[model samples]
Target: MVSKLKMVLIFISIPVISLFAQDKPELHVGGALRFNYNLSSWKEGQKTRGGDFGYDLFRINAKAKYKGVKLNAEYRLYSQGFGGGMLKQGWVGYDFTPENNLQIGLTQVPFGITQYNSHNWFFSINYYLGLEDDHDMGLKYTHNSENWLYAFAFFKNAEELNFGNNSDVSNSRYSYDVSSSGDGLYRNKEINQLNLKVVRKFSNGGANHMLGVSAQYGGIYNLDTENTGDHLALAGHYELDFGKLNVKAQVSKYNYNTKNPAGQSNDMIAMTAYGAPYLVASEGTTYTLGVAYSVPVEWGPISNLQFYDDFGFMDKKLNDFHDSYMNVTGVLITAGNVYTYVDAAQGKDQPWLGPVWGGALSEGTANADWEMRFNINIGYYF
Candidate 1:
């Protein structure tokens, strides 16, 4: 007896396989296995350092393209406490022209920098706020030319197939998790969200520069509380590239507002997918600066060596809350299909700061006036 879930998977695969069999679509299969080793220390409490080692993640991605139609999907398994097996992205798209396309399914939202240029496996702070690796069931239209890129998308839900929270009251304090209790900052499960981004590029003095603007609006209604809350963000980013050197920076201001039947404000604390959520006075500004320098080296099997620094800062609107910031410095070594990242990071008033590859430090209770973590990640792709 096949389970219903398995049956659904089989049904979804039929058309994909048929396309390859009949239309002879181009197919590609690839995957990566990642591992991590970490050591961490805190400023106030434990005088001794703590460490851990484990498999970070295993991921497989497949894509097929025939004429103007394409399909892309990825399956991921996480070993850390993050979660279990899940679909990272699965989308089908149609290309009307080389520069224009329409995508429908579970895909990334077009907001802020699409890719972080950090050498560390862990991305900057924006990632936690649904700016990186954030995907949803939606429809997106994209247009790209030699000098301009534009994207607009609408998502029915911020996340799909989440079973972590079943209770009416959201006990979890994260944004990515479904919250029924209203404890979750982004508790609205049925989110009607819209996102937009536009960028323009130019070249000067052997370098390329890009400037862009991004915006997002999302809302969810809590049936239990008969209230509604919404998330809003507006941001701008700039990127500069000179041969082997690259610099990227972005600034964003966001607000989460809620209203009840009594006309009273019930704005919850701001939270991310992971780490400790903080109280916001309704709005805050986040900034990220990342710089990378690639060095051409022919040492052993090493093809490239890149050193980088990624910094993130958050300024809360509330006067009672202290500012938060994180700084990560790392080196990336690439040898053929294998890549390694060695990183050192520290932060204050930021419990979410850690390795991108998982396994570093646990959430601390006290404000991290100064906490440090060292991490190393190795991955191989085939």
Candidate 2:
């Protein structure tokens, strides 16, 4: 009698579920959980303490669509890299045609390579200077064709982080945003920015190439002086794919002209992220070059491997300021929903790689020795 009653309830719910599925608006939610292990050469204590292994992050990805309207959002909680849980990006968009769309709210800026310029996890050095993979509160229009892509955006400013008792809560967000110099010396913020990006893609002799150019202009508002200065960045990038090998190259230049409160030097600007504020050179040129090769494997549950080498450099024009350099060699392994990266990274006068924790992007040390970090990151995706 109990089995018969359970069968009757199942028979009733299948059609009910099918009915709602046919008419309901579409929604999808997914996320990832990641962890990290690292041993740094610069941290001498870690040598005796053994390498550190810890939680990295857990992030949510959500998308919803109804008719022509769409919504996309991603939020993350970090165990190490952020002050607290933060919204990575959230936007609402509309599709007017099959080839074009518009997005408004906290959206990605169309500048210097659409998604990334590096193959390894540490991104290009340009990311540290606020020139790559940066998002802002903005509106953007994008159009795509078989051989061409274009995007234009107008940003009111960077995402405003929560401020508590401090006069200026500098960091606590993804991507670099101008803040204070930590000493009462300088104050500036990103505002009123415009971006334009165009890409041309072509295929020849079984090889595909993508060439792109991006331009940006923005305001740097000073909190103490109440005057708005300006900042500009321009970049060009090229990518190629032949069989299982990929190559990426980009060059970018940036300038920051800020109006400070009387005694600040124009040669350096203050930028913040991850709950800390630091200085960066006011003017610099950056370059990125990367290459990767992939192979399919059948080692038990392991399915694929990608080996890559990515290099980035920053050239500061200020007098006596040393440049920054980075290179990462790594392999990415995939097994169904589990993915992992094994990387050996080295850098000189670089921030996260580290002998210098602050201002390494600004006036770097004089011919510093290279530092190394052996790291592994693993994640499970849903």
Candidate 3:
């Protein structure tokens, strides 16, 4: 099947190349190699057994621009002790303007702070940002202006990353032993997603501020279990400069749903919503606040030299409104700082490496007493 797909892509690329070859344009290709090391404390039986040194990302990206059309492809390879492999996202985009385009193919839905933010790469924020997954097969349209921007995407089911009620016994191979947002998170034969986002900027002379709104609806049609949910999110970001001090704040909320019927899992039977008609799977909201003080290296050849630190927190409230017995709450906090480098010639690339520490606390008979992680990550784009 993989060979067949590759053949189809090759056939499609031939005609596309022929059409673009007439324009005589420039082709640019590049990628990055990144590594991460975790000095985390762990307990036996925990799913995330820490691998000391992990090749976080090794990717190659190719893009060709001709006339008003652009074609891009990215392939990534990752490895840890368990094993790793490769995946690719190949898409074609046509620009209506220099800053506006309609792109179709596999892509990332730009919905939340962490969705498009690259600064937090070295430190995985699965526990904090609720944006742990990667790109999916989809069609996306994007528009950007000076002070306002928006995007919308339609997607197919990408189930490898779902958790919480969405991963029930019938739909997922794994047992529904643990509970979280995707508890019964399973996709039937039919799965699709629609995501939309809009953002407006504000300023008071010092620096700009942003207000963002996002929404996503995913459909799952399976007879055994219906795994459908919607996500609504709102956020704000502000940047202020006062002589030698800089401050910023950001926050977001994510609400999703899933299901677990009676006698499915031992844990499922104990939940209040088991016998109820509608089950309230799981939901959570998270936020981030940060501040930094920096001074330029006056005589040095450095660009914008600065020192910074940020604090982040996330809280999850999980319960079936119909089933209170299966209820729990989870909280997390993290603090980190890094040396940020800036270079205009590098385009959107920013290199940051830092030490980050965080801890997880939960109540209501969910899983463990507590889970914590400490890691150092270095990331850059070329």
Question: What are the root-mean-square deviations of the candidates from the true structure over C-alphas?
Answer: 10.2, 6.3, 13.4
Model 3, 209-271: lDDT tens digits are: 666766666643332455343444455544455666655555555444334333442111111
Task: Count clashes in each candidate, considering only residues at least 3 apart in sequence or on different chains.
Answer: 5, 0, 16
The CA lDDT at 39 in model 3 is 43
Q: Tens digits of per-residue lDDT for model 2 on 151-199?
A: 9999998887644433453477777777887777677778899999999
Q: Which runs of model 2 end up more than 4 angstroms from their true locations? A: 1-23, 162-170
* Local error of candidate 2 at residue 112 (angstroms): 0.9
**Candidate 2 TM-score, C-alpha based:** 0.92
What 10-residue stretch in candidate 2 is worst by lDDT? 161-170
Q: What tens digits encode model 1's per-residue C-alpha lDDT throughout 1-382? A: 4698899999999999877675666899999999987777642232353466779888899999876689999887774355556677789999998899999998887877775524467787666545554677899999999999999999987544544443332222222432332343333454788999999989989999889999989875654465667878898998999999999899989776755334433543333343223333346788999999999899889989999999987776755555667899999999999999999887765554422221111122234456677889999987
The alpha-carbon lDDT assigned to residue 61 of candidate 1 equals: 93
Please state the error at residue 95 of candidate 2 in Å: 1.3
Give the range of the ten consecutive residues with the poorest summed lDDT in model 1. 355-364
Model 1 stretches astray by more than 4 angstroms: 1-22, 43-50, 117-119, 162-186, 260-267, 270-282, 354-367
CA lDDT, every model vs. true structure = 0.70, 0.88, 0.45
Off by over 4 Å in 3: 1-22, 43-54, 80-83, 114-118, 122-134, 159-190, 221-223, 226-248, 259-261, 264-281, 292-306, 319-374, 379-381
